[model samples]
Target: MGGRDVATASIWDAAHRRTTVGLLTLVTLVAFEAMAVGTAMPRAVAELDGVAWYAWTFSAFLVTSVVGMVVGGEVGDRRPPGPGVLAGVVVFAAGLVVAGLAQHMAVLVLGRAVQGLGAGVVIVLLYVVAGQAYDSRLRPSLFGAFAAGWVLPALLGPLAAGLLTTHVGWRAVFLGLVPLVAAGLVLLLTGAPGGTPPADAAPWRSRAGWALLAGAGIAALQYAAQRLDLAAAGIAVLGAAALAAGLRRLLPRGTVRARRGIPAVVASRGLLAGAFFGMDALLPFVLTEQHGWSAATAGLPLTAGAVGWVVAAQLQGRRPDVPRQRVLRLGALVLTVGVAATATVAVPALGGWPAYLTWGLAGVGMGLGMPSVGVLLLDQSPEAERGANSAALQISDATASAICVGLSGVLVAGAADAGGPLWPAVLAAVAVLTVPALLTARVAGRTVAPAADPSCATNLGR
Candidate 1:
């Protein structure tokens, strides 16, 4: 678990190379999809006449991701990370096609859910590959590279999505990704005998049980957001039970409770991601509603944030001995400032700039925080369990993101009925996140120093 086992993780270089190529492609797709849709969704909503359903479509992908991450972790632990990554890419791209071709809001939501499952599989395995194939020295660079890959989505996605929606149609947004995923599959599996490592995997019953729990729970949450009726409540309860069973199967013991060390780290990833991404999902809406800004204008500020992340990641990767927890705390503080800045929206002079500032700043924080977490989580993993443990960390992100986004949906809907002030919704979202950010900062502060035992970096968030 310590020195020798950690060192052995570096032996899988060819595997790592293959995985990086495949995952970079996957991340590119995710980044593009998220960014493009953000810009396009407003137009899509107008056409679809279903503004109420917007949040659920995004949340559905995320909630199902939780289960996918858990299952991915379990399976990644049991087998090579390659095949899992391939399968995920295919599933994700296929869902994109479905979404592009959809005729109704219901079908679009279904597509998002399917896409979410694939996202989980791709993300966990990508992280698993990093944790298992890279050592302490190499891991940071890989994480940085991963972040860099994501920047493409954050940068070009909005512009492309907006343009595609404007010219071709919103459906073209989904249509564009099919070839990329297919090409990636070919590149990743080429020269291999059986293709990516087949997931001989655990029993079907176990897999089905977890899937049922996650799929149903997310659907329930979607319904709950739409209506707070007794039916929704009952469905949510059942879904919660299913999720519990799934988590029990997928995560390490005590992860649900956030027991110390690695489990704590993993849990923090979920909450941290939730606190950040959940609020972010609504920013485009805020801009368009509050400032009457077009999607393209609203998305440009993200360029600055993306650049900042790329710069920070490069710096972090170069400094191999930097304590990861400090990096995480630094990111949290920057992000908290970013989140809290939305209060400035009350000023008309500032216009939507506050929203853009906050959104862009959060991107920088994420860039700094995300890769550091990936590196640390892998550092904590033992060799045999590297893939599994790495997957767990990512699952934490997906699960928490889903829940947080779903909760945000409920809050936004509630706010919509009562004047629909953007700042109030922002405040509601930021308020819940502060608790986790503080906790994350504290834990990050403590664990970071042990990564290198530096005196100065020891109390970064303390």
Candidate 2:
């Protein structure tokens, strides 16, 4: 019999089954770790006496991930994806061990930084693998599967982490995941296909210097945000300069300006991530510090949001005929509304309990937008440049998230120093940050590239 048409084939079909299962397993593990950390962080920082440095834990991971993203993209373009993924899993497991054993906030931060490095590599390589292994028509289903992987973790990770942190100590949250990573490694090794690099892969040149510079710039900016002195101004300026210099080399030309096509797609990812995650990183803190909720209680709203996200993502996947730009625009508008409503929780009289509902709305927005961006990106990218473009997308997210989270941290730190509530200040910072989402919505039209499968050489400058 003639071979079945790949376009209409299910991701679970025999030819694709192992890789799909392995990819979903890995994604679920990553999502579980992310949810667990968010739920456990408040207690973890309190015991380590790092409440004032709270944002650093997040920023440190994001900054170092930028470096890893650049390197991973380069490696994926030049070699087989399997070995790079294996290396990343090993490093990630080591970081988990270090974090679980931490006796101080500094050590925990160090461990988080290492985890970021490995995660960045693993995620980017996975995208390259997806691009290589599946037909374009099958990608929406694959991305949907990836989002579904987050669903179980979103539902249970918070509750599990909270129970562990309360009953067994927060250390269990990190250490417990090591075995899962090992299992994912086994699946990946068995399933990942061997393939030759693209014949037109760009010549390898070292991007490490630029990546490190960008990472350092973000770290310096985060540190400066925590200070309330004149030197902070100087440091912020220097950091901005260094970050600009570094990003110019790493991202597509005109990405900073939201130029048309792939650049616009990359820009949208940054804006959406910055607005959502910036607030997400601070939400648990807002509840515990401002509302006096228990760690477990604070995590519930996050779980609600994840539910909304997964639902919307699955919906989007089922209807691949919808224009991605339209979905992107709608998601941004919805998120803007959700953020505005959630801000009311900061007002002392509002009771703050409605965040459970409002934040889920925000999650729905992200669900619609994020996967749309991913699908659009791959559809636009030529085979040889898929790895690099994927890196650019991730770097945009990490850089913007670090900046947004850092800025919010500054406001919260200032409020705490003055013996005031943190929620009001965070409310204001989040309101201002929503501007980017609004801009993204307005420019969503530009994310479509002019050519069918435009390569980096022809597409970026437009």
Candidate 3:
């Protein structure tokens, strides 16, 4: 059957079933680990007496992951997806083992850095796998499935992690996932295409150097965000310059300026991720501290948001007739509105329940925009450049999210120090993020040259 025909048939049709299942399983495993570990981190830090290094736990992962993404993309472009993915799984599982057995917070942080590296490699390879194994027609569905994979994890990961941490110990949460990692590895390997070296190898060493510099810059910014002073501000300027310099070398040309086409797609990914995730990182805290909601009640908004995301993703997947740019613009507008509405939770009269709804709307916006960017990225990317471009997309997201979250932390801390309301500051941060999202909406609308491959359908005009 033709690729389009196969796509119209079903994602579960015999021809596509194995890859679909494998990719979904990989996403699920990753999603579950992310949610579970985040939930258990507080206890883990307390037990290790590393409260001072608490933020590093996350920062370590974020920084190292940038290196992994760049390396994995290079590897994926020059070699088969299987080896890179398998290696990532092995590294990730080893990190889990080390973390599970750690006696000190330092060791745990080290393990987390290793885990971040593995996650970075695995995610980039997965994107390459999708680009290679699936046709354009099926790509949207595949991306939608990837988003849906997060739903079960979002619903259950925290609960399961809590239970295991309470009864079996937090260590079990790390060790127990090792087996699932192995299972995911098997599926990925089976589904991945055989090794066929590229005609020309990607320049790895230079990219690696740039990635390292970028990682260091990001680390510096993370540290600076925690401190509020003129000296820190000066240091932050240096860090930002370093980050921009490294990004220029690592990402496609004009990415820093949000140039039309691929650059815009990459820019939008960063803006969307920063606004949504930064807001997300603060929501639970906002509810508990400002509105006196219980932890579980505060978490409800996140759950609602996840559901909204899945619904919108599925909707977008089912309706390929809609122009991808239109979907992106619509999603961005929805997200801006949702975020603006969510800010109202800061008001005394609005109460907290509105957050559950507004956040869900924001989730819907993310659901619509995120997958569209993926589809657009794949659509615009030539076969030879898919890995590198995919890496750029993910790297944009990781870097932007880290910076935005850091900024939000600074805002919240400054608000607390001033004995003022914290939500307004956080809301201001969220509001500021919407500008890029809105501005990039038009940039995302710009067209790109069609893929060089004739067999691949072009959605730019459609």
Query: Of the candidates shown, which would achieve the greatest lDDT relative to the real structure?
Result: 2
The stretch of ten residues in a row with the least summed lDDT in candidate 3 is 447-456
lDDT digits (tens) for residues 198-310 of candidate 2: 88988889797898899888888887887768999999999999998999999999897888888999999999989887777778778778888898788788888888888
Instruction: After superposing candidate 2 on the true structure, give the runs of residues whose Cα lies further than 4 Å from its correct spot.
Output: 1-4, 37-60, 98-111, 150-155, 165-172, 284-296, 346-349, 412-427, 453-462
CA shift of 322, model 3, Å: 2.6
TM-score of 3: 0.92
| Residue 315 miss distance in model 2 (angstroms) | 1.0
Q: Whole-model lDDT, candidate 2?
A: 0.83
Per-residue CA lDDT of candidate 1, range 345-376, in tens? 53557786766566677767777777878877
Superposition TM-score, candidate 2 onto the true structure: 0.86
lDDT of 3 by residue, 234-342 (tens): 8798889889888998888877677767887888888888888888888887888888899889999999899999999999998875767778888888888887788
Q: Model 3: how large is the Cα RMSD against the reference? A: 2.9
Pairs in clash, predicted candidate 2: none
